[model samples]
Target chain A: MSPAQHEPDEDPGAPASSHAVSAPGAPSAARPKVPRRVAWRRLSTISRARLSRGTLLAALLTLVLGLALVAQVRSTQTADLENLRETDLIALLDDVTDRADRLEDEVRSLEQDRSRLESGGGDAAAAQAAQSRLESYQILAGTVPVSGPGVSVRVSDPEGEVTTTMMIDLVQELRDAGAEAIQIGPARVVATTWIGVDEGRLTVDGQPVAAPYSVVAIGDGHTLAGALAIPGGFNDSVRRVGGEVQVTEGEELVIDAVHEPPTLEHARPVPPSEGR
Target chain B: MIPVLGLVVGVVLGLMLQPEVPGWLEPYLPIAVIAALDAVFGGVRASLEGIFNDRVFVISILSNVLVAGLIVFLGNQLGVGAQLSTGVVVVLGLRIFSNVAAIRRHLLGA
Candidate 1:
């Protein structure tokens, strides 16, 4: 539109028109010549106007596209489960079920042994020794069921902001409150229980535990509740991270779930020192 | 020259930041990138031919990205996302190849 811009526009057209005139003699030029000239003229006219804004817009968009591309590649690379084939998913499910069946069989045998120990005839001293041993084994192995006054904590992470670290802290807080036994859903927390994230869900011993996580702790109900209710405690932490936690005292809280004892691959138990 | 500098900066920022794309947008990203690539190649070809229109280049880039993403999204809703994505890629790939060929012919005179 400006007189200054029109001067350069006409300058480029002079050579193009001269070339068009000289190219008419060629046999192959006739078919494509007319359209090519029109396109050439139109492009020069448009490129001359508002050059800076257009180039900047294109650059910004390309930057965004580049960022999205790199981000997507990195995300897909890190997310292993998303790449699983149908057969792989099925195999994974089968493996989990098999493990569950084996654990169930172990639980059945442990229960039978517990019943026999209680009913078998024995002298009072021998019976008392056996009872003590059973209690210790039950506590360590997380096999025997426990029922006592305690607190139940229900945690819900609607936004998935709660990490595995937060869950571990919650469990630790319960233990610090003198919790003797704890059950998270069907999985019992033992000395060796591992908490981790699997497929975007919290997992205890490789078993996925969904949100609205129920935590039952066998301890003094008031003490357990107070620990979680303390300032900057587990409940406060969950709330800070866009999650919810509810704690309630109960007269009788039962945790019957058992944990699978880790099979030892190394290091046998050393005999107690004789001098002691 | 400016566009090339922009591209280099874009690539560097992409590499250095490594931001995480949300889960819902993952499926559409690669297709949109391919479409943008086609537009860039076409722009290069136009510039070589002395017919590069800035407005046309920007409009084409925007529309190409949106349309490509839309096609894939519709395909996903219809349960044919993978097939349609292949179709979009093949078409855009051909466009890119032809545009590159034009640029090569203009610059190298081959």
Candidate 2:
């Protein structure tokens, strides 16, 4: 027994090796109140203190643990899917299958629409399916001027009291009343159209148009005019701003403004399939 | 602490090598690592209790890893590889948590 290790405090927890004790059962029965510092000292001084078989094997095993630990950590944390349970993987596969089935159903319906339109297009119906697709595209793309039975709205605001809200409300009401094609102050109101205020001027798609704002919407003229003149509706909101609301129902309203088709750097029409 | 240093050296060696695990070893590697962890926790607890036995530690570590890998391999043969792998991990994970808890109390005297 070394006199230094018998100082009671250091010896109590320094039994990392069997050689540190006279009897194997003696150390466990001794004082168990020592700090972890003694154990730390016992382990830290392993090369100088003692090299028992248990300590040696423990060291070797710890080294293996380290290698395995890092390897396992990297594997689990990486994009590898090895850690997932079979049930979890099955569930994921099932979810994907469900999504694919839903997409197939949607494709089938779209294919049905195409077949109806493409009774005989000399090409597959993918790119051309729905009835009135050409007219719809022209109207939505704003590539061609449109005309039909519709209503014309002219609001003259001498005081310039008309705000952007009134302008948007006017267009929204026309849309709700089934206006198929709408033109507000030389700008065709397509899907990408925006109504906002810039420098205290009402802007349609970033282009400012001064009052009196003339809006022509091609749709059912009777329905558009009636929707605008509804009590306390768009007609009242314009008059509330001290602007004159003049709505005229025409059998045919012409909207000559055409928007330049957007140039495509990425998207291109997929070519039609033969003998769909 | 010196044993911990051994582990650190082992970690550095592993990182430097970064050897790709063989395809057959891929499934078993993670299982073996976790099983080895259980053995490590038991060893640390035994060391603190002055009951660490090198022979027992070595046997337990080897058996744990082998048995875990075997279970996964058998499951794959039976068309339930994923399920059996889950079973091994759950059992080993439970054992590891309990051993770690013991080690914590032993060191902290809590």
Candidate with maximal TM-score? 1
Per lDDT, the best of the predicted structures is: 1
lDDT of 1 by residue, A1-276 (tens): 322222222112122222211111223331123245555554454445344886777667777766766776777788787645445778998999999999999999999998888767555887789899989788767987888999999998899888889989988999999998999978999988989989899999888998889999999999999999999989999999999998999989899898767689996876689535
Q: lDDT value for candidate 1?
A: 0.74
- Put down candidate 1 lDDT per residue, B1-110, tens digits, no spaces: 44555667777887898787777777788898888888777776666555555667777778888999999999988978778988999877766665565444444444
DockQ of every candidate structure: 0.12, 0.16
Counting clashing residue pairs in each candidate, in order, gives 0, 0
TM-score of each: 0.42, 0.41
The share of true interface contacts that also appear in candidate 2 amounts to 0.36
DockQ of 2: 0.16
- For candidate 1, the clash count comes to 0
DockQ, candidate no. 1: 0.12
Q: Please give the distance, in angstroms, between residue B16's alpha carbon in candidate 1 and its true position after superposition.
A: 1.8
Which ten residues in a row are the worst by lDDT in model 1 chain B? B101-110
For residue A128, what is the lDDT in candidate 2?
A: 56
Report the lDDT tens digits of candidate 2 across residue range A239-276: 88788989999987899999887677996676678425
Q: Candidate 1's error at B26, in angstroms?
A: 1.2
